[model samples]
Target: MARVPQARRQFAAKDRQQARLCAEQRPRAPPKTALGVWGKAAPTPAARRVQDARAHAANCNRSTVVLKRRGFPMMAPGQVDLLKKRGKKLGEGHFSTAVVTRWHGADAVLKAPRQKPNVGQFVKECGLLHTLEGAGGAPEPLGLCLYPLAQVISFAGPQTLAGYLEESRSSAELLRLAADLCGKVSEVHEKGIIHNDLKFDNVIVDGRGQIHLIDFGNANPQGQTFCLVSKGQRCPWLGPEVFSQHLSSPAQDAFSVGFMLDTISKLMP
Candidate 1:
């Protein structure tokens, strides 16, 4: 090589110094973790499946506009005052409260979240109920409310199965109710929806003794994983595998039905 000029040598050294500084300042790739790469834990297979299922539900099923066109209009905030005037508190739960009220001159149950932050659970329940519309053993979804965030559904009954069980009933009647409950659960499963929280509290029995399954907050599409974040209280009816694997299937609901039947059997005289 020919002798380098002093000016060129200085320029080359400065370039090298700048390159080293740039390399030092550049962020190194985050170390990979067992869960994922870039220091962000990757969502597990179960989580991904759950996310996909939720996304599908939100995109395809949770459309208030579609429901409105289908005859399920949303209740406005102004109507909430009327609801309060005519409605009677039915029950209260961790996330939502139910009230018996009149909607459009029909008996209806208005369920709203305990707080605005819990509106997501109400929306999920509304979407699932809409999907189960026309199916037997489920309450008819009337519409959804916006301001306070509530879902208007046909009143299932005056009492829940839990309260109904308190009344005297012959063994034959209990057995029949058990069968009816199982049939209703089967109907839901047929619709490809899993009522993850299946219990006496969620079952409404009309004066005619007809059973209706309510509360789809915990419901998920078949094959999706159970939502760990929003999991409710410890349920005796849940299968062991559900907690261990976080997977949801019709089998989990089956286990709950079985548990309910077993409990009813014990009540029989």
Candidate 2:
């Protein structure tokens, strides 16, 4: 081994001293799994029942057991108008009002169906958003509110990759963002879930440059009406068999990501 310089030797000695101090001063975290990942705390008895209720509560007319069991923080009705609407009316196309809203001093996009809201779709969307909580790119669904006529999901962020691509940017940054999006979508599909309405507008981006997939009104569980709509840019994101009403798979999500990358590239100046 080469002899250490005096300055270098002093730095290593200080590092060791700091490590020892930290080990003594810091509180220990809960034990991690064999793979060094933190293990999730087991749900309480009440929480378990809530999970079951959410799973079975297909429609908005959920049973009392569901309402009571699901301990979701209830936002008072009529609080919807309190949110400050921001940004340009980002080109709404769905059967809902897709306006961006600001809540709790943060940027969160809101989606509330205009026609009679689809309850099954609401449940699936909540499930997917909640499931992929911290995987990245995907926006966090702050809360899902059920109404008599319509339901709303609050997501954190603004405009999707499509909106970003509309302006000039570096190709490398675009590709990296696209790749990160693909990885998150793969995580979604791996959970045996499918986001039926996958498109640019549905993918929201925040100020920190993160991608969040939104719009769950068209989402469906494994054995539901797998209605496929191939409109506008949706066609490129969807697979060929998607036109035939075939159910979505993980590969379909990858294809959608690939198309999104292509679309982003074309818009770059």
Candidate 3:
């Protein structure tokens, strides 16, 4: 009985250590997890089978970007202002609306939180993205900002991972996407940010096969602990630790990446 708790702690510690190493570009083998936390009832990803662009678009869970003017515009620091609202709603979750808007003279997405609590959540995510971006060679996509209007992030190309899977693709292509996603989660963990939410819908791939990870509203900084009494936010990507009401940690992020990789791997024939 004592060894069980001790072993779990050891695994978690190693996960956190791996996260730090990966964030810093120290090459290491990825974590190979046992079925310690995943259960049979956990959500499994479905195979996407569409083969053409038209078919992919039709099959993807997408919303046309709605272009409408807000009565009041949103403004970010650095003189960024909404010049135009672009398209229909790109995506919407329980906490935010992901929409395209012209900001600082470029097209950007407004990941606007829907409520007060969500605002704080978005703010924290923005901070993490900025920090990791700086550490990761100042990547442009990480330049997310909390505008009085919304949390503005760079707009990824059309097609979520699910949609990308639908397009006719090679086995090599599938492996690249999975590997890239694994790298992304590790990169964030290196910075001590736990992405509480990781799913196919949040990952976008362009027509050219470029990958983008978006939406960090549920992320938390290192060492901050939150009680698991809430029910509405749990998703299928989460691990058993989360289901058991433990605090979110870097290990959970690893578990998510593990499942994400497994899910994407099966997309190949």
Arranged by TM-score, best first: 1, 2, 3
Model 3, 124-190: lDDT tens digits are 5655666677331112332333334355666656578777777777888888877777776777778
From the highest lDDT down, the ranking of the candidates is 1, 2, 3
Cα TM-score per model:
0.71, 0.61, 0.60
Which candidate has the highest TM-score of all?
1
lDDT tens per residue, model 2, 10-129 = 999999999999999999976653432365666667989998888766544463236436544334446554542353343465576665666677656565666676755555565566
Full-model lDDT for every candidate:
0.79, 0.62, 0.60
Candidate 3: list runs displaced more than 4 Å: 1-87, 116-118, 134-149, 227-234, 243-247
Q: Record all residue pairs in model 3 with backbone atoms less than 3 Å apart, i.e. clashing.
A: 65-87, 65-88, 66-87, 66-88, 67-87
After TM-score superposition, what is the CA distance of residue 206 in candidate 3 from its true location, in Å? 3.2
Model 2, residue 144: distance off in Å is 3.8
* Model 3 worst lDDT run, 10 consecutive residues: 63-72
Q: What is the per-residue lDDT of model 1 for residues 1-269, given as tens digits with 9 covering 90 to 100?
A: 45568779999999999999999999998666665465578888899999999986675455655666766667777787678778999889877888999988888888877755465566667777778874647877777775556778888677889899998999988988888888888889888898888878988888888788988888888887775343656678877666654667888889888998988999989
Clashes of each: 1, 2, 5
Number of colliding residue pairs in model 2 = 2
Stronger candidate by TM-score (1 vs 3): 1
